[model samples]
Target: MTSAAPHQSILDKPFVLDLFAGPGGLDVAGHSLDIPSLGIEWDRSACLTRYAAGLDTLHADVSAVRRDAFESLPPEINVLAGGPPCQTYSVAGKGAGRKALEEVKAYIERLMAGDSDETIDRDLKKLSDPRTAMVLEPLRYAIQATRSHNRQKRPYDVIVLEQVPAVEALWHHYAKVLETTGLPDGTKYEVVVDVLDTETYGVPQTRSRAVLIARRQGLGQPFLPEPTHLAYEAKDWNRRAERATSGVHQPTLDAEASAPEAAGPPKTDGVVLKPWKSMGEVLAAPVGTHPGRRTPFLVRSNYGSSGIPGRRGVRTDQQPAATVTGRISRFVVFEHLDERVVREGARFSMNEAGMLQSFPPDYPWSGTAQAQQVGNAVPPVFGAHLLSAALGLPTPDPEDLRKPWQPATVEHRAKLRSHGCGAGDACTARCPRPEDQAPARSSAVPRKKASVR
Candidate 1:
């Protein structure tokens, strides 16, 4: 269904409706490309952040919007975009989806077979984790949107969905069903699905995600954009971040270990890939102009605590970060005055975590759970490339990814601080953030703490 067909201008009247729009990640990407987007989120925390960023937001339920599509959504919405909840399918979370992969597939089939909303809702509750069923939400909307397209009424030009790589099989199911949608001259959702490397797209983290891009057949082939940066080579597990403070204590979670391998090597036709961005460079200064942060340091993850000899995760400034998560703040940075003398370890501030996820350094991070919101967000830089590919827009310039972003001055000093920590708590490597939901540390082996001020 893909081709090297001429591109058309979707900018003339583009309106995107992003479901599960956590912290406006994809919306940030959309706005960066001058595309108009409205993100619908049920989480009040996320919606608060969206309002802070000034991203058009609809604080409503996706399923309810599905029921009231015509009344809630405008007729000009051409793009349907979202990443459904993947808690059950995420390798890091419960294995419900994996345990019942066949059952999940069967559910997809049932949804395609025209099951009523009440029936599907009841069936979805049977799963241990209801999030597993949310994956089908996009499909439900697509099926309805395609019906509109068939009637040439408020037709959608494209639909894109993303989720954990473990959900790749589910997306393939989405592809087959959408391909047959609007058949015989209506909007055929010709799709391409695959896993994308975040670092390969200029993000300074090695996170991976499964993506599905579907364009109306009339718009020609919809290809995932070529990687703009070389993929990082994993270093030996024994490698340390240039400090003599402590020996190997825990094993990093190795989030990318479960990332579904791309079906084939990335297509390199007509594009040159640059070296992937480094943690030091991105944290140091805006690629082009800003010069506030001059001191580069090493980042030690709070992820891997699987106490094994020579098993640790240490990221040097020269390397890309492992994965940015809510607990990223717990990961301390060993400030290097020279190379041998290390200063007391300190964790990233709210803005620092945002930058690692490719959000503007000044992006307003409002409300609580700021770290989780930033961590869970789709890297805006990567999203820009994806939207460009899906919407027939010109590929974004590599420099644009590097350009200094306009700072968010939405009452910089007014937003609330950490979710649960007191303003005077003096959070450090040992701060047991009560608000975070990670499992408790293993009590058998005593852990070392970073020297704090």
Candidate 2:
């Protein structure tokens, strides 16, 4: 938990190359921690967003970028960080895991050779699917391609891989590859896998991601950040329960509650289980009075379950929001309306959704459709925490960061408490029904009945 000095400046700091950088969330966090960074992204709008954030961005596919290009740069890059595309490994997508590997393999081959001509194109095209292989394959190649440099006494100090929990299995291969290289097995690299929620890091949302931290030789073991904010159930105060019982509050239950009684919580805490950020905190005013000023279809869908039109219907003063997702279908959907009020005819806007993900208010996203950009972003606050930890900087003060973006009301705890439940008592409201609780009747009258017969 190293803290940065007040006079410290990120300008001219150690360099980082952000691969597959989306909307520059990682870059933003890195810069906040005083780490200088550049990004490589294929999406035009994402490039614009990065540029607006004052980041040096390359508008090209990461796989197409060669190691020489990086080698040629004046500054020495200390780290390589990015979350490669996860569609192949995502459960929502067809499980084309192996195909995804080939795609990365082809990209790595081209990058290593510094060639992206017909041969590379042909190889890339040969892969019919990209969902079967581990999403980190390209990263593996990037590291190996750069390994020769390590032998020359210069190597990347760290590589951070962010992805869905499903990608954890891929780290073994990455570890093995790092070992094979001449870098000392334990000294050269280490892998850290853990669940991180944006809320804990002071983001308004409760998005949890599986973060993998791998450090090159000579650097200290990459830090796994401590939880800054606990989930509703795990919070020190019973704030979650208070809000839930209050008429003014409506908390989004985790996705597990949707399952049948017998089915247990998902083995992996799916993103749905995380708390949610409110819509009002995130949405911006419509661009103009005209219909064109209204929000897009997908952005409106984020609030569908609340039965409130236009507004995300989030109650402020609650825990941060759940993890933001790309598809509206994953969570309950909301209706679109024109006004900001949670009225019948109001609509939801894309800007609001982006705020929930903790992107800066001024982030420049130049896409016609807002959902695509919003879906691709990682919450900037979450990224900032990780970046700070990695650089051995101090954690941001909780008060200085955004408070949990949940709906809140000023009600006494006693007013919200259940009638039969006490401070230490188990919840009786969820207990078995009265009839089920009755003891079974005994059958000791058999002899008397026989005599009577």
Candidate 3:
């Protein structure tokens, strides 16, 4: 596996264009690896936050790109990536997408069958939730890139996407369509789809996403990133967390566990693969803080199967976090075994919440509904691993994520700020994000199943 292109020099880095990019999670990861990337997001708050973090961004609806609103896109961009909205398809929420699953698959078949955009749009208008149709949006770009008629005679070298696990079946359909598609030059794509656990890739959350990567054929076989951190059984995590909540010291992993990976054994490019990271790792008091002053606490989630204002779920600081959703404000913390403390900063700060998603501690989060952006982001740590694996490049050392966002080969984000929005009058136009005009407090997340594993 290598980053060298088939026809280009070994030193040329591929450029990336990400669609529906929420707060630049993948962009952060791309920048960390020194790969140039630009994210197109419609949400004003998310775009503002991305700008504050010095990430390159286009604050516009992805649909606009379809209408040729962006004509100056660089021809050098050979990688297309995005994670479209998944609320309609999410099992944890309304079943509009789930109920229309077969309809969605039929749409993919129709799309690949050369159905016109007008035809697809006309039929899509019949769906209960308009967002359900957005699931097929990524394919529009992918298919166009492969066409010889487009100005760019060459196809994108790689295409990547991710969404909630409920979208796994849809991604499989994508893989099938992509592999079978061929351009006049006999160029086709090879695709792979997998349900990836964020924790397995060293993310502090247990979120799972259905990811698809389609590499233009003849660019070597594509593969998913090997898991670095071992998976922890939910029961074990709960038991260990119980002990920690009761004042017992809970180590990262079981010291006496028989499993080699559980023991933090070395593997994967000879780097020592470690146990899954815990909330304590990111949530622990800063280095200069007095250790004795930081007391033990557990996060209590107010939203769950028991319903809001009913039975809540709790996770200890010693364990990885339960999935952090867009409604992150629902999770609160209390004194260990006491619910009434209401301590200062007990509710996670924006930085703490972002860190839980493997974002840099100082990743400048700006604008309204910042929590929604953090919750919606793909953890940058895991994003780097996925991109590295798909691009046939070296997977980075996960241990190095602890320090401030500095990586040995990474350039400062300030150098890329030129791609951000223009100032003054030029930025006057509000991004066309009609769907994002909702009250920040009313943000919704797909209902997730209790993560026992």
Query: Please, what is the whole-model Cα lDDT of each candidate in the order they appear?
Result: 0.65, 0.47, 0.68
Stretches of candidate 2 exceeding 4 Å from the true structure: 1-12, 92-95, 98-126, 130-153, 179-187, 233-319, 327-342, 345-348, 397-453
Span of ten consecutive residues with least summed lDDT in model 1: 443-452
Candidate 2 vs candidate 3: which has greater TM-score? Answer: 3
Instruction: Name the best candidate (by lDDT).
Output: 3
> Per-residue lDDT tens digits of candidate 1, residues 223-263?
88767777765533233321122453322223343122344
Q: Each model's RMSD to truth, in Å?
A: 9.4, 20.5, 5.3
Q: List the residue pairs that clash in candidate 3.
A: 92-447
Q: What is the lDDT of residue 152 in candidate 1?
A: 52
Measured with C-alpha atoms, the lDDT of residue 170 in candidate 1 is: 80
lDDT of 1 at 357: 83
lDDT tens digits by residue: candidate 3, 93-138: 5656567677888988888877877888888999887677777878
Model 3 scores worst on lDDT over the 10 consecutive residues at 2-11
**Deviation of model 3 at 426, angstroms:** 6.6
Output the lDDT of residue 179, model 3: 78
Evaluated at residue 303, the lDDT of candidate 3 is 55
- Cα lDDT of model 2 by residue, 398-439, tens digit: 332232222112232122122112222223433223343212
Model 1's TM-score against the true structure = 0.77
Give the Å shift of residue 364 in candidate 2.
Answer: 2.2
User: TM-scores of the models, in the given order?
Assistant: 0.77, 0.60, 0.82
